[model samples]
Target: MATHKRAETLMDSVCEDMEEKPEPYFSFGIIADIQYADIDNGYNFMKTRMRYYRNSLTLLKEAVQEWDSESTKPKFILQLGDIIDGFNVPQKTSDTSLAIILAEMEKLKIPFHHIWGNHEFYNFKRKYLMESKLNSKPLEDEIGQLTINEDTSETRSDQESFYGYHFSPYPGFRFLLIDCYDLSVIGRDTMSIKYGMSLKLLKEKNPNEDLNSPRGLEEEQFVQFNGGVSGAQLNWINSVLASSDEQDEKVVVIGHLPIHLDSTDAICLAWNYKEILSALQSHPCVIGYFAGHDHDGGYSVDASGIHHITFKGVIETPPENQAFGTMYMYEDKMVLKGRGLVLSKTLHYRNGRKEEPVH
Candidate 1:
C-alpha cells in the first residue's frame, strides 16, 4: 500500500511539471489565401459581404513586417496559396499581378515556401507555375529530389515543383508541403492522363452538369474546386513518413486543402483525404496538419492526438481587420499565435499507435 501511494505521488508530480511551461524547438510564419488583386472590392457568389481584394496587399505587407520584426525571427514563411486573386484584372494582366505579390514576399529576405491552390491555376499552367514561379530552379535540375521507393527504383522527378517537398529546419523535426492539385481539373491539359482521370472521377461521383456545383453531390468534397492526391504522390508521402519514422522525427504537413473532415467545411476538404489520412495513420511521426481553404477556419484533434488547423483567409478580412499567424513548435506541443482574424490554439503532441478517425 505504501509503495503504490508513493508511485502515484511521483506520477502526479511529473504530470504537474509537464504542464508548467512550453519550450519551443523552432518557429515559422504562416498565412493563407492572400488572394490579392488590383480590382475594386466585390462580393462573392452569394453577395453576403464585400471581399477586400485590393486591400489584401496591405495585409500581406503588414504580416511580413510583423514576422520580420519578431525577436526570434521565424525560420521561414509558409504561404498557403492563392497569393493572386482569380478575378484580378484582365487575363493578360494577371501574371503581372502575381509578380507584384511575389515582389512583396521577396522584401522579407527569408526563404518563402508556397503551395499551389485552385485560384493560382486560373492564371497559369502547372509547368510554368512550378518551374518559373514557385521553384528556385528549373524542374530539370531537380534539386533536393527524393526517391519514392528503393525496391522499385522509382524517383520523384516530375514533382520537383509543387508536388511535394520535405524540409527539416532542425534535427528531429520535418515539414512536408503537399500539392493538393496534382490530380485536379485545373493546370492540366484536357488530353493529359491526370485530367482524364479527374474528369472520370467527376463524372462518376458528381452528376451535376456544372461540376463545381454541390447541389446533387452526395459527398460534399466531390465538387470540382477541390483536388486529390495522386497515387505517385501518396507513395512519396508514405515513403517520407516512413523515413521520418525511422529517424524518430516529428512531422507537420502543410497543404492548401484541409485533410481532416472536421477541420473545415466538407466542400473544402481534399478529395483523397481519406487515403491521405490512412497513410498518415500508419506513421506515428505526424504531429500536426495545417491548411487553408475554408476562410472561416477550424481546429480539431484526431483520436491520435494530431492537430488539424485550417487557417482563415486574408482575402475575407475587411479593411482594418487581418488574418495570419506564427506557429511555435515544441517537442511536446505547438503554440499558434494568431493575429487579426486568426484564432490562437495550443495543440499537444501524441506519438503512439493510430486510433479511430475523428469526425
Candidate 2:
C-alpha cells in the first residue's frame, strides 16, 4: 500500500508541473469606443441607450490601473478609436475631452496605439488630427522595437494621414493596423479629392439627400458614414501580408471598422468589407481580425478559420459598469479574457484545435 501511494503522489506532481507550463507568447490590452465626453447621457439616433459620457473616463482609468497591476503586464495597449464622441461640441470641447482621455491613457506608462474613426473626424480635420493625435511616434521599451514597414512610394492626395501600418512584435507574429476610413467624408474638406469621391460614391448608392440617412439605400452597408479601404491602402495590405507569410509569421489585423458581417451590425460594416474579406481569405497567415464600432460586440470564425472579434464599446456600458479585455496569443490559439460586459472567447488556429481556457 505504501509503495502504491508513493507512485500516485509522484504522478500528481508531474501532472501539476505540466499544467503550470506557460504557453502564451505575449499579451496585450484592448479597449474600444470609450467615446468620452463631458456632455450629458443621451440616446443614439435609433433610440438605443447611451449612458454616462463622463463615466467612461472612470472606466478607462480603472482599465489602466488594472493593467498596471498585472504581474505579466501587457506588451502594449490598443485603443480601438473614438476617444471622444461626435456630440462633444466640436472644436470647443473636443480637444479638452481628448486631452482628458489621453491623460488617463498616459498613466499606463506603456505603448498605446490608436486608429481613426468617424467620431474622431467629426471633431477635427484629418490634417489637424494627424498632426495632434495620430502622429507617428516610437513606442516605448522592447515593444517599441517592433519595426513598421512604411510604404513610402504611395502618397496621399493632400499629404493626408496614412493610418495603416504594420508591426512585428516577435519573430513569428505581425500586427496590421488598417485605416478603414480611407475614403470617408467626415475627415476631408468639400473640395478635397477624396471627399469628392466619397460624395459621388454616396450619391450613386444612397438616394437619401441626407447622406447620413440609410432610408433609401437598399443595402445596409451603403450608408455614407462607413468607408472603404482605398486602392493604395489595399495594395499596402497585400504587400504586408505577402511579406509576413514569406517570413512564416501569422498576422492579427486591427481596425476601427468591422470587416465581417458576423461580427458587427450590417450597417456598421466597412463599405468595401467584401473586398477586404477576399484579401484576408487569400492570406493563409492571418489568424484573427479585431475591430470596434458595433458597440455590443461579437465573435465569429470565418471559413478560412480566421477569428473576427468585435470589442464592446465602453460608451454603451451603463454608469459604473465597464468593458475591456486582454488578449493572450499562443502557438496555436489566442484567448480573449473579458472584463465587465465583454465576453471571453478562445480562438484556435486552423484544424479546429482546442486549448485550456484563459482564466
Candidate 3:
C-alpha cells in the first residue's frame, strides 16, 4: 500500500517534467471499462459503485475526438475492454449498445486492440467474440512487420482464441495481448471443460452459492465475475516471452483482469493470477502489465521491475468527467499523459531488476 501511494505521489510531479524527457519511441492511447449501455445510471449490485451506463458512450466519443485531434496521433488505440455494460443484455439493448460504441470508436480511424472482460460475457457469447472486431488483429503499417511465418494466434482460430500475440510497433519492443478469460464460467456452456474447471476452482475458493459474491472468501479472486488463464494460454505466454527474449525485445502485457493482488482488489483479479504473475516476474523481458477491472484503478511496481497499472474505469467516471490517456514509450521509461481522472505516471525501469522510483 505504501508503494502504491508513493507511486501516485510521484506521478503528481512527473507530468510537469515531460518537456525535459527524451523523445518517446512510440505512443498509444488507452481507455478501459467504457461499459456502455442504453440504460440510465444506477448503482452496482453492492451499491458501492455507481455506473453511468448511458454517459460512457459520450465519454468514448469525446475521447475519440481528442485522440483524432492529437498531432502525433497514437500508432493505435488500446480499448482495455468492457466496451459495453453487462446490464445491456437484460435491458434489451445489447445490439444497439455495441453498435453505438463501435460507431464512436470508428471515428478515430486508428486500430483498436480490445481486451475481453467479464462484462463482455454478459452481452455476447465466446463463439461470437472469437470473430468479433473487438479482437486486436494486428494491422500492418500500424504494427511492425510480421515475425511469424504462420499465423497461429487468437484471431486466426475460430474455434478458440487464446492469443498470446505480440504487436511490435517499434523494433525490440512488443505489446503482448493476452486472453485472461480463456478458462471462465461466463458465456461458456455448463458442460464445457473450461467451464467445469472454473466451477470447480470457484467452489473450492468461495463458499457462496451466489458465485459473484466474494463475502466470506479470503481470496476474493474466486468470484464468478473473474476468470483464469488456461494451461494452454500460460504455455503460449511462455512461448511468446521466449520468442521475444530470443529476438531481444521487451514486452508489455495487456489484458482485462488485473493479475497482481496489490494492483487491484482480489475480486477483480484472475483466479490463477499467482501462476501468471510468476511467469511474468521470472521473465526478464516482460517489463509491464496493463489492465482494467477494478473501477478504482491502482499502480504498483513489484519486487521485480515489472510495472502493473490497472487503468481507471470509464463507466465509473461521472458523466461530467472522463478517464483516458496517451502512453508514450521512451527507451528507458514509459510516460502516461492522462486526460482527466487518469494520473500521469513515469514507469522508469523497463528491463533490469534494479528497481527505480516512479518519477
Candidate 4:
C-alpha cells in the first residue's frame, strides 16, 4: 500500500474528487481498560498491569517515532475507555495511577483522545442531586465535561466532569470524543431541584438491573440504556458525516466499545451487526471504525462494508489483564504490529479494503 501524502496539493486534489481520492489512512494507538491502578501488593494483577503499560508504551514509542519522521504522523491517539479500572477509588490514588501511565504516553507528542467507561462514573449521584453554586441555573441543564490533558492526566470538576467527549479539527473530517460513562442525560452542578428528579427516580427505582454488579449487566441493556452512539452523540456524528459528505472527505469513527458490543450480549455477539451495519449503509463516507473492549484481538467487516477491530490486551498475564500489541494505521490500511517485551507483527488491520498485516 502506498503511503498517502497529506500535502496541500494532494489534499486539494483528493477533496476535489473524494470518490477518486484513495482512502485517507492514519496510524493510531487504540487500547481499552488499561485500568491503571495499584492492586493489593499480594495480588499478581498489579504486577501484570504494570508490565502491560511498560510494554505497550515501548511499542507505541516506536510507532510514533516512525510516523513522526513522516510529515503526517497520526492525527492523534484514541483510548476507547477504562484507562483505569476503579473510577470510585480515592481520587488521589486514581490520579497517581493515571499519572504513571499518561506520563509515559506524553513522550509520543500527539493529542490523546479518551472515552469515559462505566468505571469512570463516580459522582453521578451527588452531582445530579447537588445544589447550584457553579451556575445560577440548576444542574440538569448543564453538560458534563472532562478534559484529558496532553500529558494524559485527567482533571474533572463535578459540574462538568464528562471526560473525552469533544471535537478535533481535521480537514474534511470531524472527530467526536464522547464520555460514555456519564449515563445521566442531564447536568449535576445545580441542586437536585432540576436534574435530580431523574437521579431520585433512579436511586429509588434503580433502572439499571446490574447497578450492584458492573460486570454483570447484559450488553443489550447497556446499549439500550447508554450504548448506541445516538442522542446528542448520534446527532453529532450525523452532522459530522454530513459535513464530510458535503466536502467529500473521509470520516472515521472511534469508540471504546464497538457499537455491536456496546448494545448486545458482550460475549455472544462479537460485533454490533445490525446497528453498525445500518449506520454504515446510511453513511458511506464512514470509512472505518476502531474500538477496544474484548481483551483478545479480533476483526470483522459487515456486508454493509464497515470494519470492526478489537485490539489485543496490554496486560498479557494471569486470569485477567493480559499483554498485547498495539495497532496502527498505515497508508490505506491499519496495521497491528506486536509490541511489549514480546515482539511479532501478527495482529493489525489494513484500510477498509484489507485485513491484518496491511502489507
Candidate 5:
C-alpha cells in the first residue's frame, strides 16, 4: 500500500512539472493486459478485464478531453499487449475482445497502435503468424475493404498479423511498437527453452516415453519463446532504430514484457532488454522503455541514462490487480508521474496510513 502511494506521487510530481513548463506538450495514455472476453475457466474471462479497463479508459478519455478539448488529442494511444488472452482461449473470444478494445480506442479519435502479446496467437506460438508461411490469403480475400491502404500494407495475413509499429509526426519523439514474438517457425534453441529440460536430456529423462509427450510442464508455464530479438526481426528492429537515429529522434520502446525485474535484477536476454539498453544508451534520442507483464510498478536505471519502467496491470483484482499510470518527458526535467486507481478500500486505508498525503 505504501508502495502505491509512492507510485501516485511519482505521477503527480511528473504532471506538476509538466504544468509548470513554458512550452506546450502532448501526453498519451497506455493500457496493459485488458484480457477481455473469457466466459469462464480463466482469470479475467467474460469481459472482467474489460469491465475494469473500460472504466480506466473512460477516466483517461475524460482527462485527455478536459486537458485538450479545443485541439487534437495527444498524438496517439498505445495498447501495450495482452489485449486479450488469445493464446489461452478460443480465437473468436480473443478476436471479439480485440474488436471491443478497438472500438473503445476509436472513440478517442487518435491513431492507436497495438503490440502483439504471447496470448494473441490463440494460445499458440507467435512465430507461426509472423512471416507469410500460414495458410490464409491476404486481407482482400478475408476482410475486403476493411484495410485503408493496400499499397502501404505492412500486414501479411498469410503469416502472423502485425498492426505495425506507429510513429508520431510530433517533434523530439518516436514510438516503436515491437512485435517481439515470431510466429513463423520454431527455432532449435527456442524449442529447447520451450521444453525446459533441453532436447538432449529429453531422451534421457523419458527414455521409454513418446518423443513428443506433454513435456511434463503445465500449459500456463509453457516456454515456446525465442527470448531476445534475433534473425530477421532483430535486423528489422536495428534498421528501425538506425533510421530513427539518422533523424535524431528520441525513442520510447513499448513492449509487453519488462526489460528488468524489480524483484530480481535478472535480465531476460531473449527480448534483448540489456542489448537494447546498451544500443540506445549512446543515443540522446532514446529516452526510455515502457512495458508491462510483471504487473508490478517500478523503474530501473542502468549505468547508462536510460530508464526502464514496468506498469501495473489493469485487470488484477482489488488488492493485487490495482491499476496505475506513469508520465515521462512531459517537461524539461522528464518528471515521472504515477497513480493508483480502483484499489480496495481496506488496502487504500492501510496504504494511506503509511504515507504523507499530497497537499
Candidate 6:
C-alpha cells in the first residue's frame, strides 16, 4: 500500500513547476510491469497487495490513447518489462495475452523498446526469448542498429541468448537496455550453463529450501525471483560506455531490476547490483537508470549523482488507477508528464549528476 511515500512526495514537489517548463528536446513514453493476464484479479505474494490482472490491459489502452492525444507524440516508447504475467502460461493464455498488449503498442505507430524482467523468463524459455520481439532487436525504422563498441552483434542466436543491447536514437544520446536476468535459474534450461551458475550461487547464498523466500537472509538478493548479469554482459556494457565517453555521448540506462539499494526494497534488487552500480559509476557518460519489478516503486540519487527510478507497477495499481508517463528531456533537466500513480517531476542534471536537493 505504501509506495515509497517520502520519495514520491519529494518527486511530486520537484515536478510541480511544469506550468512554465520550456519545450523539451525530446519526449518518450514510459510504462512498466504491465504483467497483464486475462484471469480474474488476485492478491500479490504474502496476500498483502491486490493486483488487477484483467484491468491492466484497460490501463495500457488508456495510456496509449493519452499518448496519441498529445500535441507532440513521443519519439519512442519504453516498456520496462513484465509485459505479460507468469500465470498466463499455467492457464495456457500466454500468447493471446501478449499479442493483445502488443497490438495496443503498435497502434502508436512509433518505435518502442522492451527490457527483460524475471516474469518474462517465467513464461518463455531462453531460446524462445531470443527469437521473440522482446529481444530489443527492433527493425531499422523502429530502432537503428548502432555499432556498440567491441563488435557486439544484435543478431539472434543461441549464443547471444540474453537481451542486452545499446542504441543511440540521436547522435549524442544513447540508451543501454540491459538484460538483468542474463544469469538466472528460470529462463535457461536446468542443464544450461547459466542455470547451473544461478543454482550454485543460490545454494551458496540462500539457506532456505524455498529459494524465493527472503526470510532470515542478511542480503535478500539471493532469492530465486531476482537475477544478475554475467561478466561477459558486464564487459559489453563497459565497452558501450567507453564508446559513449569517446563520442561525448550521454547515456540513459534502462533495466527491469532496481539496482540502487536505496531506490528499491532489498528483496527486489538484482543479484550482483553492487557490481552493476560500480560499473555505472565508472562511466561519467551515464545519467540515470530506469526500472520496474518493485511494485510500490522507488527513487534515489546515488553518491555518483545518478538517478535511480523504479516505476510503480501497473498490476499493483488499483483497478481504478493507472501508472505511466512521458519523460521530456531538456538540456539541463528531465521532466515527467506522469499519469495516475507516477508523479510529474523536472529533475535537473549537471555533468551526469543531478543537483542536490536543498533540504
**Top lDDT: which candidate number?**
6
Which residue ranges in model 3 land beyond 4 Å of their true spot? 1-20, 138-164, 353-359
Candidate 6's residue-wise lDDT over 22-99, tens digit each? Answer: 788888999999999998889998799989998999999999999999999998899999999999988988888888
Residue-level lDDT of model 3, residues 55-168, one tens digit each, is 888899899999999888998888888899888877788878888898888888888888888888888887777667765664423433434333355445444455446678
lDDT against true structure, model 1: 0.81
Models 1 onward score TM values of 0.88, 0.90, 0.87, 0.56, 0.59, 0.88
* Candidates, ranked, lDDT: 6, 3, 1, 2, 5, 4
Name model 4 segments beyond 4 Å from true. 1-26, 40-75, 87-92, 122-174, 182-230, 261-277, 315-332, 338-359
Indicate which candidate wins on TM-score.
Answer: 2
Better of 3 and 4 by lDDT: 3
> lDDT by residue for model 5 over 164-184, one digit each (tens)?
353643565667665554321
Which scores higher on TM-score, 1 or 2?
Answer: 2
The regions of model 1 sitting more than 4 angstroms off are 1-23, 89-91, 136-162, 356-359
Task: Please list all clashing residue pairs in model 1, or write none if there are none.
Answer: none
Model 2's C-alpha root-mean-square deviation from the true structure amounts to 4.7
Root-mean-square deviation of every model: 6.2, 4.7, 8.0, 11.5, 12.7, 8.4
Model 2, 72-150: lDDT tens per residue? 8998888888878987865389888888899888888887888788888888887787678554334412344333454
The whole-model C-alpha lDDT of candidate 5 against the native structure comes to 0.46
Compared to the true structure, candidate 6 yields what TM-score?
0.88
lDDT of 3 at 91: 77
Q: How many steric clashes between backbone atoms does each model show?
A: 0, 0, 0, 22, 26, 1
- Residue 27, candidate 5: C-alpha displacement in angstroms: 1.1
- Give a tens-digit lDDT track for model 4, residues 189-237: 3452323533553344334554332243333333222323323334444
Judge candidate 3 at residue 62 and give its lDDT. 91
| Runs off by more than 4 Å, candidate 5 | 1-20, 38-72, 87-92, 123-166, 183-222, 225-227, 261-272, 317-331, 341-359
